[model samples]
Target: MNDIWLTTGETATLLGVSRQHVVDLCDRGELVCTKAGTHRRIRRSEVQRLFNPQLTREQEKSLWLHRALMGHLMLDPQKVLQMATENITRWKPKHRADGIAMRSLEQWEQVLSGGVDVVVDVLTGLDEVSSDLRQNSPFAGVLSDVERRQALRSFREHWDHEHTAA
Candidate 1:
């Protein structure tokens, strides 16, 4: 009893196809339609179903992680770098501790800045960093290993399942 419906022309327009193509899809049962007098009517839900397939659990998690990481990077990358550098310096003090921490920070910044081709590598590195920080840094209680592992797992699963052209 979903009152929402779309005419064949509307369906075609939404799909970016010709009316004939929409009709063909209907004929092939790829898109379900019902006859309404002289014209065909497609349910709004049916059109949505055809256009937007359901994502798997891993895919959903990957999408969420990707968005969250990208949002954090875009919003305040400096803050992220500062926290990471502090953690690195505290965890491992050496002759060039600041330089070493800065190098890692620079690499993370480069990845966020689109210099790196593989996103999974960046995510994996972040996961490793988070794990190290959780174990050794004063911020250990603030960071969650479970969350980092989940994001890393999602990224790894997504990378394994999809063949990247890059």
Candidate 2:
């Protein structure tokens, strides 16, 4: 119970889902969590039930820690997730997804709001001029924990190289 409240990644691994899935669960009121800005904090009691709803006296002694945890940690789920996502991709750019023009900010917003299904990111002229825009959106698909980091690393390096050359 003490350990479950340690970190979200730990909890998500215990729950067998992505960090984002955990966040979504929290957002939708599906899972119990306390939020501090972007970071989410969860307790064992919040996550324990999902692992095993049915209780036993033995489990109650350990307070529902998976017996496997007493042994080695589970195998890396990243490989399976990577292989699965090597096909069904998400957050792909609009221009890449469709041969559409991304010539302006309005066009990007239009694509996002006009029911053209893709994760929409808007970079505006606002210098802290804010709106009701939430960073996470309904259109944003399930981006697993593993894939998200790989994609970020891959793209950031590419972008950096391109900028350096120019």
Candidate 3:
């Protein structure tokens, strides 16, 4: 099943979208695929992601931290941007040989350049790209030490509550 590839129609059926919509996703680069003669073949895992946007526990924790950063950004957009720019510059060399991280870094650079609204969107977004961006976030130390600890504490408590209830 790991190597399985689905046609546009098959992918559409799994996602409950039209075949053309699947094609549109591929064309938009939201989904990656390879051409099989005249048709596109998408990976099963890719379709699964469309169905499940839920982040892992670590990613969830990171998102919680970024949410705190989001609030800080609103209060001091320029300072937050400066911090991100510095982090990006400092981290870029470390990820130079890593294609995915480099791309994520590039996107972060573009988002920072786009201004406060763009950065907010990425910080709060639950989309695949957003999740990926959060994983490679250059906004480290944007929140004060106390703020970071408080945010993580709250997240952990809530996460534990949810899992325990389940």
Candidate 4:
């Protein structure tokens, strides 16, 4: 239990997938693994990487912006949600012919309609769906210009510190 390696079933539990799926991922070269005698062993880090794949600099920055919005959302859920609704209403017409953007916008509408818990989940999600939704985020203008600048500055400073420390 104190070992750094995990069994396939353990990895599956962490990834919210079946053990066979973890095996398939290892076989497909999606997740790295090694054999311990006849059993497969994966590093804890490998499982973490699969569950939370790394983000690009731009994606990290976007996450920071949303985090700023999330702060406001917590303080005033109705007002934050209203701004998102308005943004969706405005962007929907312009993106009517754009399949990807339209899908993201539609998903945003559902998330917003589902209320604050749903919104918070999607806002901080690091999954592919959340990443795609963020590409066409409807939370624009939820934060003031000064807030946006502050969030971005904070992100940059943190990013710099992390990289330098590493």
Candidate 5:
């Protein structure tokens, strides 16, 4: 029986992962998927397919691209584009320099609602964070805790390279 698949966002939410994680898993042959307008659709049957664990051409490409991007970021820190994801400001403000200024949408409702260029820190629950702001933010998106942990390592690698090179 052919079962209808769920959307990437839905699967990502249900799986407690980022949309990018969902995409990556699908690309890596861990999850069989179909793409529709930048989103992915995962079938229930495909979940079982993941148990087989065989690499496909698509998976190879995905893996290669992943390695290439990581290598590029490591080798060429000068070309990397950085963006701010979250900003938390305490009651006492500190000297700021580089990027966007962010504060709680709760305490700093004015700053958040001012339509500034940076992401606003709105008071939100974890579930709300997965649903609402994740969809809207161009600069940030939700990732599975595992993915976040890995991404953090990847980021650290890049940052460390930049520091050493400088």
Candidate 6:
């Protein structure tokens, strides 16, 4: 199962590019592949590595946490809310600033318990909060953006690998 191999066409389709593009990538040594008689055969892992590269241990853990949180949000909102509240409480003290009140946990619980619409509102409100904080906390903003991108990239890689393997 882990030894899945894809032809150039299949690789191109998975990568959302042209077959010639995949060929070019292989030729340029950007994508690893082996020749199967006349055609090129690329290992699924190689293709995935080309798209996702590698992440540090902390980045990997953060991606796993993000995926688990998203799964919980979809399957068990109550559990997600509970976990989020606990996490907020644990991290609030570390992030406490002069004007920042530790009131978000209460508000988060309220919105999470309200319904889907309220959850959406909470997400929107969090975006605004992040923006406001970003202005004063440039390091936090950079770290957050990097974490978010890594989480999303890892999630997409897992999703694509799962479906493609299936």
Candidate of highest TM-score: 4
- The candidates, ranked best first by lDDT, are 3, 4, 6, 1, 5, 2
- Between candidates 4 and 5, name the one with more favorable TM-score: 4
lDDT of each: 0.58, 0.43, 0.87, 0.87, 0.45, 0.59
lDDT per residue, candidate 1, 1-166, as tens digits? 3458888888999989999999998988878999988788899899888656555554445444544455454565565545555654564554354665545544544444453233334443324343332222222222357766776776776776774565
Candidate 4 TM-score to native = 0.77
Cα RMSD (Å) between model 4 and the true structure?
Answer: 3.7
The best candidate by lDDT is: 3
User: Regarding TM-score, does 4 or 6 come out ahead?
Assistant: 4
Model 4 regions lying over 4 Å from their true place? 1-7, 15-44
lDDT of 6 by residue, 1-166 (tens): 2359999999999999999999998998878899979899999998887566554443444435344345446676666566655665666677655435445544554555587555534332223442232222211222246666776777668656754544
**lDDT per residue (tens digit) for residues 95-154 in model 3:** 766588888888899999999988889898878778889999998888889988899899
lDDT of 1: 0.58
RMSD of each: 14.8, 21.1, 6.1, 3.7, 16.4, 14.5
lDDT head-to-head 3 vs 4, winner: 3
lDDT of residue 19 for candidate 4: 96
lDDT, residue 88, model 3 = 85
Quote model 2's TM-score.
Answer: 0.30
Error of 6 at 157 (Å): 23
TM-score of 1: 0.35
How many clashes in each structure? 0, 0, 0, 0, 2, 0
TM-score of 6: 0.34
